[model samples]
Target: MSGLMQKEYERVKLHATVMNTLFRKEPSDSESPRLARGQRKTRESFDARSVLKHFKDYEFGSLTIPNIHLSQRFSTGQDLYYQCVAMAALPKS
Candidate 1:
């Protein structure tokens, strides 16, 4: 699983770079292009700890992961499960 994830991460990084190089247009002399918020976030360091609690909510009656702070009640375990899934769906770099 780790190997698979590493491959996927590399694939996405390469694809992003290629797409940026091939399709991104240069700004006109009067304009400057800025990276989108999502692009900027992608470049920022990812703190897995910040999001880890969402994953632990998958366990029965668990309110928090070891290192993450608990903030609110989760209405149902499934809700937390989906949150974990969403986090997992994000590109890892």
Candidate 2:
């Protein structure tokens, strides 16, 4: 994939991973202003460093893509696997 496409993919993956982690953590103090007001608060926002730390040293499975046309690359599933692995290997930054 092109660098721009790769970057965009990474951004989306990171966001999803971070959001999942955030919601999975323990609930925040309900005594806080926002919560005290009875407003619902699901998860708090965190910095990139925190998200990177959560995903550091993670690894994903590898894949082998068959030699084929772009349009049919993922028809056999291998190409999709390869793309997922490629995106997972991207930098956490």
Candidate 3:
């Protein structure tokens, strides 16, 4: 899981860098006003390190994985069964 997370983080960082570079380039006069404004805003506000830090913190920092163990004891030749469970923490509204 850690290895996969690291790879995803690296990918996101690279994508952010590419997007920032693209945003930094000036658009031609024929470009739409809305697009030009959006690009300007992104160039001014996008911080790759900050974005990466947020991603790391959200995915790794606050996440919790509890250790779960299952045990079974059978008597009188009865069968035993167990079901898998999954849980997630959602933000409170």
Highest lDDT scorer: 2
Best by TM-score: 2
Query: Which residue runs of candidate 2 sit more than 4 Å off their true CA positions?
Result: 1-38, 50-57, 62-93
Error of 3 at 3 (Å): 38
Model 2 weakest lDDT span, ten residues long: 67-76
Q: What's the candidate order when arranged by decreasing lDDT?
A: 2, 3, 1
When 2 and 3 are scored with TM-score, the better candidate is: 2
Please identify model 3 stretches exceeding 4 Å from their true place. Answer: 1-20, 23-45, 57-93
Per-residue lDDT of model 2, residues 5-88, tens digit only: 323333332211214443353555465454455454566665779868887988867756443322212223554422332222
- Give the per-residue lDDT of model 3 (tens digit) for 1-93: 433212323333211123534235556636745555324344365557977877775654464435432222221122333232323355554
Give candidate 1's TM-score: 0.18
- Which regions of candidate 1 fall more than 4 Å away from where they truly are? 1-42, 59-93
Clashing pairs in 3: none
Clash pairs detected, candidate 1: none
Q: Taking the tens digit of each residue's C-alpha lDDT, what string does model 1 give over 1-93?
A: 543222333333211121223233546624866667445322233356766777766765634323322122222254442122112233333
Q: Estimate the overall C-alpha local distance difference test score of candidate 3.
A: 0.39
lDDT of 3 at 59: 50
